[model samples]
Target chain A: MIRYSRRAVLKASAAFAGASTFAIPSIVHGESDRIRVGHLTPLTGFLGALGTYATLGMKLAVEEINQAGGIMGRQLDVMSEDSVNPATAATKAQRMLEQDGATVLLGEINSASALTVMQVAARNKKLFMQTGARSDALRGKNCNKYTFHTDIPNTVMVNAVGQSLLRDNMVKDKKFYTLTADYIFGHDLLAAAKRFFGANQGNLIGDELIATDVTDFSPYLLKIRQAKPDVVCSNLAGNQVTTLIKQYSEFGLPYPIVGFNLNTADAWAAGDGNLSGTWPTVWYHTLDVPASKAFVAGFLKKYGKPPENHAWIEYVAFKMMAQAMTDTKSTDTDKLIAYFEKETEFDILKARKAHFRAWDHQLMQEAYPFTVRPKGQANDQWDFIALGTAVPKAGEPLEQLAPTQEQNPCSL
Target chain B: MQFGFLLEQVVNGLVLGGYYLLISLGLSLIFSVGGIVNLAHGAFYALGAYGCVEITKYLGFGPAVVLSPIAVALLGILFERFILRRFYTADPILSLLVTFGLAMVAEQAIRIVWGAAPLSASIPPAFRGSVFLGDFLFSRYRLLILAVVAAVLLGVWLLLHKTSFGCVVRAGIQKPDMVAALGIRLQPYMTSIVMLGVGMAALGGAFFAPITIVHPAMGAEIITVAFVVVVIGGLGSFWGVVIAALLVGVVRGITIHFAPAAGEASIYVLMFLVLLVRPRGLLGERIEKFE
Candidate 1:
């Protein structure tokens, strides 16, 4: 599946990038002495804890690669900085690449922050193997050849779960109420839910978006309790997810809740069976197979805690970068990208086999549909067993949802 | 959407009002007597939450109880003489600014020392369930919180109105020259009053810490609502502030039920409307102008 003509793609100004032909620097073209990978994440603010966990995962991945004879004897020299804001991420991207000599940069959990870093990647000619952002626009129209997504995009995750429900007969004419965290992520996830539901047989009765900084959900829950839908879809993470599900259960809304992002293993860790029986669309989980189990076990053995879906993405990014480096047998940025596109079936952190789409640069991997179990049968972060479902090839010639890079100029 | 929704919103508003009342009472008391707003009041609340979390986390205490407020008050005394005494005679606004900076410094300090993330506080293991109302359910913890707040308010009122020290402080606020002429050193009393007010804020913070995260900006965010209560209640009028706190909370709560978008906005509207009604506020005493 790894096809390469090596013809240079058209280049645009900094105001726009239309899949430019990458010019490899003469220095690291054939040599494999050492490759520096840069990373940026928010280690402060409300989302700091999640950011730290993601950062630690990247560091651990770097360590594993270094231990195993390095990337062709050139270890990943880690250079990380805190992208606390758009301005900060932009600055860090410069320092990591320009000053620190990072060949490829990875790690940004926040999608808004990732778009900011994308500008830096375009300017510096470095590959940003985006690890944890889920915005759908990162691929397709907004996508650049220099940009390779490691995180599962929302459209991909939604489509996987949507199709699964259709095949499994889970998508019946069920009424849904959404308690979305009010933001771009929340809005897009809810919209996808509505689209998928419309595509399938599911019906959306009501939806509400909660502000990001809202400390309490009791007031909002009051309205939800009154409406009482069959299903409640939520888009929230970290402690907010923990607090909401706990309060939702307390309100005793007879509704069965299913959230795309909320029903992760991290939710269970923060909350004790608060989200049991909820189904979520996830990139990878341990329950699917042996690689996932080993990854989770290795993570727990080292970190002394279970690897949530976020951690799996970090592990995968590490493996992907290592694979691209191995196949090209060179550390040049352009050659590495060519090697990535040519990468047919690579070893991901979780599943034994994963394929990346040549058209969209989207990784075709398995998504999980987990049914949360009650208190008695809980296993660490997981509620119930997870079922494996395959995501379709990413670059479908269907209707494009997000404005592509050519349409939306990020620099301005 | 329904009549029940409005009814439920009112209930929700009351809960918010009650919480604000607890937080603002301390702020108002300190401002009238201490001549400072005590911005660090939110920190006390956060610390109270952290205390409860720590006690429960390490010691496995049932839940962080109202006893946290008492600890916060004592902590306030240490902060008072060292910090408040230095700025007693300065401009009132200067003191306010100082305290505001202190609040920021205190919050960051707390975050640096304790780590910036939300901490967990349980509904006292005993009262963790919910009580059914007509259509909605209310947690026993919230009811217990309201009850504790009431008791603290009563205790603060009793101490302020009943004690001779309270009389002297009240007299000093009314006529500082007379109190000073009578040979009472205002420094000790002013310092103690500042301590008392800060302690109350800390207590409020500690109680709320469980409900919210112990983040650095938390103090600044809630302070707006607390300030609104202070402004609408009339500066230096204790009861007026109390009533104002309740009114704002209820307004915010009900707004959530109905509009949800204008939860904080409705509070400002209520304040403007109240200012338009009675120039000094409902319970504010008229002052004789002095040059």
Candidate 2:
């Protein structure tokens, strides 16, 4: 029989607790030896589907970087989780930097969540690679020195699709009714759309602000019928966009539908025959660029599916971060931020290299307008989108599609 | 012209309400009979959507919608036999917790099976597009859904009011002790009620899959509304649930017309107002077991 005095048990328990307390810092120290990147994206909710692809793309990037001996010969450690909502995202971002020794932060598709995370990163003075959020306000008035945005903003998306609409003579004098998602992202997109409409002489007939969780668009559709607009524009985001697309097709309204923002995953979820009109995308799997093709092939081999646009952006964002770290040879926030602010061009699996605009820290990259391929023309489920030529044409500057200094309120 | 638009919204809201009734009535029935809240009811709805989407690839939409709910009803048998049966006489919280856990497990299982991306399902070409009836425009597909819902409502109402099975179920809901004293075994009746409940939820999923995003969390999305409908309608009343579902839909539509940003929140506001006015629900009958 084993016996122990009460004092002896107490002393042993104290020592065990003391040991674990000491052990945690050492584990954190070891983790700090590597570049600890905290990644957050919505793994559940409306943006969850895109976040899944985002995580996969970031994982593939991390794997490739580690295989090539990692950034500056230290392995990269990524702690990824669901950024659930704006409040939770801020909480997790703070915890990642303060407690987990994460030197940098990355990943968020929801613009609202990204804004919260950006605030966290700024407070901690850590670099946040705002990978997939497209709200213009993040780059405009809300822009900060610590956060750099990679995806095309609302302005770029509107321009990308707007140019196509203009070429087809669909914007000028057109009676446009818009359905905007009721969130920071949707509101920002609607603002940008309004700017485009005002500049192009498009008549704004009516608009509705739709809540994010709305699954049924029947009532809204009835209103659209009542308005009888010449063009129906969607400023909705995530799964809501897919829902609207599906229901819109079901109603089969006479007016053509177009969107300022549409992720490839959302479009794919709208299915083959349902999607019509034009939409702007950051990147698609079917790009003719060699690097993109390679990335797509590698992704297909690993996951048995083509990578969505969120996945592609996360992949390039990580690679961009790795390049910045390698160039500067330090994870120091100032050095990394300085390196990016210098406008060092990066190959983002596109025809032209993309660079972060110095003032706004928004990535100046080519965006594309896409329409669904004709029925029976698509080779596979993911091959439905017919990607348009890169906007800003060959001779035009990439910044032509992005917001100008006067238009963007960013002062940083 | 403004009145015409409001009228269009009202009629459309009614059609949407009919769809909501399909899922909520089943939830009400299962709760009425078993004294279990069946938080996993939405999971069955999600499963029905997934099942229908999968079946549609092989069997076409018409057959898939029919087979998917029937398939889910079979699953309800297993659910009742293994999980739900043990909780019927237990504490309500225990059943709630068990069903809640089951809902998560079902959602995760679906994620594993279908992947996280939503599977696209479109309305059949023949049924796609709008039909004009005087000044009102209606989606042809939604009208078909309304017809199906009407038929199901009639069938369920007739089964409950005009049949011997319904008599025993009604008696079992009110006094399981009395039913047992009368030498009637309520276990089989409980199982049938659960099957019917989950099956109807699945049917709602199968019909809505074409118009809504068919994703894993879809069940979680719907369960809240189903609960709202059930609570607002009063827990054990069939007509109460029917009225509440339609009321919720109409209220949401009218609210969206007036205040677009508050569209989703309108249903909860409606639920809150109804509960404030009638604590027992609009038509909720008191069941002895629940009391």
Candidate 3:
């Protein structure tokens, strides 16, 4: 399968040998004749680290693109907005379009906010590259021609996790129990997990939502005793994930606890080997590629610390957008869309192995299925890396996954 | 639940309840003498945990466990003089904000002192593992926690209810002018109460350090529960606080055994329901009426 995908990519790249043929169209409106991009980020939130990285990634890509002869002699200019909330993201999206006259909108780190930004793109006819947000619905019924996802959506994670579980023979005869965060990420992950397990060989016997009612894990600990499910899939974040793991250990609750949304730097360090062996799906692990390796080394050299998921995703998404702008050969919306479709392969450290999917406009790159097992750097929760398997290029048919109406009742 | 399981659940409830009683005992005592809410009560908890880490890192586990709270209380006096005194004359909400600020300051200070990662703490070498209790089993660490909390609660009960200083504090809460008229300076008593409440919160945090995480934000998460116990048991009622603690703990224990998803919300819900029926609370003999 890997060889086949590699050969197919080689053939396609050979077919489009002259990569510079698609240069940004000349600026007629007395503009700088450069590609102007907008970044929507959350400077303050639980996912703040990721938002910062998303912005930085765009900066790095723009810098690299401009340095390498300015994208057919037209440099990439970019600006970002702090899309910390829905209203702010909507405002930022509009400002990026009308005020800044941004040619493209880089999706926010938060999925709910990304969806809100997608609406703006559809109306304004601006290209949207979604890199961070993992909403499965964005590629489904909510799919618009203008919106493109560069990161693996939550459902893709489910497919990767489920497929890997099946491959490892780890999904049989187990009763799954979900300890999920009560939000879009949690709900979507749980739904995708259920679908994945059902198709393979497992049953979601019992589940619980950790939200308003659960300030402590004392009750959930007791239910674990009562139900005694074979697997506990928890979608907890930050300190809460560490809290649950510690409490579970204290109670001596013995069961394989898989982390569904445990994909952050803080959780990795805080878990202290307790969350190790728990499986999770993520877009890029810093240990996977040379670009990532170099980026991590550079980041650590600059900041005296290692990079995590936030930095890795930002690095990939920004570069992809820059490459897209350069390939389109024009700042014009109609021309850019044609350019994006034609330039299927994105050359970057993150997605150099694979090409971008044209169907959902989601990145058709490989996902490194990581388990939160022990032994890594200190004081960080991003201890997870590619454990045993590199899930090969399996083209995720985004639209093939059920639409928003089919998935979310309220979305319809 | 089975017969053995029910007993185990009760035991668990008692252990969980003991922490509430232990922490609230100090808050109640402090409230009786000093009017401030001591919002940084959880900070004391975190301090205890950090003290355990620092002391344990330097000294052995045994010495650290004994010395951590003493170190915290000694430091607590300084905090009382520097931070808490200013808030005394301010609005009650000001005390709330100041203490909340103090809690934030302490969290960051501790993080600055002990990085963002959680450190490993264990039950003192003497009390590791579990003992068989019929069909159920109890961790020695948990059993040790029970003994410690019980001993502290009894010690507090004696110090407050059975002593002259306790008598003055009790009088101060009900009739502060009378205590002042009796020629006893209120500052020393207020300082002691502040230290005592903070010390208890620290002890709970220290004991939990091995079992729960020893990070900065933990105190923020559990402070609401501490407040729940304070409100439900009546603002200044000692015995009321004790009963309320047990009720809250047992309810959590029982519910977790049944519906774990609602573990956190259950405590507040129960507190709300209690406040609705008995407007004063479980034991509010004479509260300053707000509503």
Give the top-scoring candidate (DockQ): 2
Clashing pairs in 1: A2-A342, A141-A404, A141-A405, A142-A404, A277-A372, B44-B202, B45-B205, B45-B206, B48-B206, B49-B206
TM-score result, candidate 1: 0.80
Q: In terms of lDDT, which candidate is stronger, 1 or 2? A: 2
Writing each residue's lDDT as its tens digit, candidate 1 over A288-343 gives 56766787777878977666566667777887888778867877778877776774
Instruction: Return the top candidate by lDDT.
Output: 2
Local accuracy of candidate 1 as per-residue lDDT tens digits, B1-291: 487677776776677677788778777767666667677777776676667666665655344444566677677777787777766666666677677788778777876776544444434445555787766677666776688778877887887789998788777666777888999987888767766675666666666554555555567667778878887887567688788877876777677777777764788888888879976665655533111
- In candidate 2 chain A, what residue range of length 10 has the lowest lDDT sum? A24-33
TM-scores of chain B alone in all candidate structures, in the order given = 0.88, 0.98, 0.94
Of models 1 and 3, which has the larger lDDT?
3
lDDT of 3: 0.69
Docking class of 3: incorrect
TM accuracy, model 3: 0.79
Interface RMSD, Å, model 2: 5.4
lDDT of 3 by residue, B1-291 (tens): 475576677677877888777677777667656787877888888888889877887887667777888888888899888887776556677777788898889877876676555566655546654566665656677788889988888888898899998888787787777777989877788888888888888888778877676766667766778888888888668888898888889888777666665666688899999999886779877833222
Cα TM-score per model: 0.80, 0.96, 0.79
lDDT (Cα, 0-100) at A196 in candidate 2: 95
Could you arrange the candidates by lDDT from highest to lowest?
2, 3, 1
- Model 2, stretches more than 4 Å misplaced? A1-27
